[model samples]
Target: MAKTIFITGASRGFGKIWAEAFLKRGDKVVATARNTTSLNDLVEQYGDAILPLQLDVNDRAAGFAAVKQAQQKFGSIDVLINNAGYGLFGTIEETSEQEARDQIETNVFGLLWLTQAVLPVMRQQGHGHIIQISSVLGVATLPVLGVYNASKFAVEGLSETLAAEVAGFGIKVTLVEPNGFSTDWAGASAAQSQTMPEYDGVKAAFQAGLTDDSFGKPEATTPAILKLVDAENPPLRLFLGKVALPWVKQVYANRLATWEEWADVATAAHGH
Candidate 1:
């Protein structure tokens, strides 16, 4: 059965890749981007299977309007993929207030607005899937990506809470945590803070850690995502690349050790 999927940030990267995949599979996709002109090729190729809408996800009112338009055209949105976010590259102290605010606005608030817009539509239909495009950094930290990490962490928390809140309505929420991908996310699409001399070494070390092998091909993810959405029961969180799980395991292990090491101190603070 073909589903009507609403995807944000469909102009490029994973969004564009996944949009085409869905369309090729005979599904209906309501694809959105900041500039509709960028979606012209997909619109021409896919014809009416794709509905190209110009949407800056940061605009709350526009998000709701887009949802309304999608609902009006497709009748029901079977899936809502929140993929409109960018990487903010900078250390904590080096990150400017405006940078932090813009990051949160696009990643956190933009997601919230769209999710809210779709909830009512989904609830009425009695079934829907919400896929949030988070990152591995949401669960663990990486140097020089403090603002980006924080934004994704917020997404993780919000989506998890939303999953619980909407399950009774037959709505499913899944957080798609992808590691490094061969996309413009860390390149052209990313926003960087002004360079600080003190954090140069940290930035260099971070850049050095990223090798060609670290990134997964964006096209390869289409099958995984298709299977995910079509499953009878989808996971609350899905890691897209090879590096995420093992790294997350180590992070959790370290967290567990630290908590255990401080268990006595925590118990003393409780003071029964």
Candidate 2:
């Protein structure tokens, strides 16, 4: 059966690729971007199979309105790809107040609003899947990406809670955590703070850790995403790219060891 997929940030990168993949496979797509004109080619090619809407996900009203338009056109939304977010590059000390706030507004609140908007519709339908585009930074941290890490961490927590809360309503939530990808995510779409002299060394070390092979190709993710949404039982969390799982595994193992190392102190602090 053909599914109706609503995607945010569909103008380029992974979102655009996934949208085209879905449309090519005979699914109806509601493709949204800040500038709908960027989607003109998809509209031209897919015609009635695609609905291109202009949406700034940070605007709560606009998000709900977009959902309404999607439902009106497609009858029901089977899947929602919450892919509208960008990375903010800076160390915690170098990050500005406004940059931090802007990152949260789009990544956390914008996703929250759209998830809330679709809940009722999915509830009525009794089945829906919500996919949040998070990052490997959500689980692990790196220098010069403090604000971006924080934003993705917020997304991780929010989406995990959402998964549990909406399970009863037949709503499935998945957090797609990708490591570095050769997308505009780290290029044109990224927001960067002015560099601080003190952090120059830290920044260089961070850059030195990355290699040409670190990033996965954006288009290569199409098949993985397609299979993810098609699963009869999708996971609550899915990691994209070859590097994501190995990195996360090491990070998690260290966390577990540290927690166990301090388990006695933690227990004592919770005295009955």
Give the alpha carbon lDDT tens digit for every residue of 1-272 in model 2: 89999999999999999999999999999999999888898888999999999999999999999999999999999999999999899889888899999999999999899999999999999999999999999999998988888889999999999999999999999999999999999899999998889998998999999998999999999999999999989998888899989888898999999999999999999986
State the displacement of the C-alpha of residue 85, model 1, in Å, after optimal TM-score superposition: 0.5
* Model 1 misplaced stretches (Cα beyond 4 Å): none
Candidate 1, position 233, lDDT:
96
**What's the residue-level lDDT of 264 in candidate 2?**
95
The candidate that wins on lDDT is: 1
In model 1, which range of ten residues has the least summed lDDT? 198-207
Taking the tens digit of each residue's C-alpha lDDT, what string does model 1 give over 1-272?
99999999999999998998999899999999998888899888989889999999999999999999999998999999999999998889989999999999999999999999999999999999999999999999899899999999999999999999999999999999999999999899999898889987887888899889899999899999999989879999999999999999999999999999999999999979
Q: How many residue pairs clash in each candidate?
A: 0, 0
lDDT of 2: 0.93
Candidate 2's TM-score: 0.98
lDDT of each: 0.95, 0.93
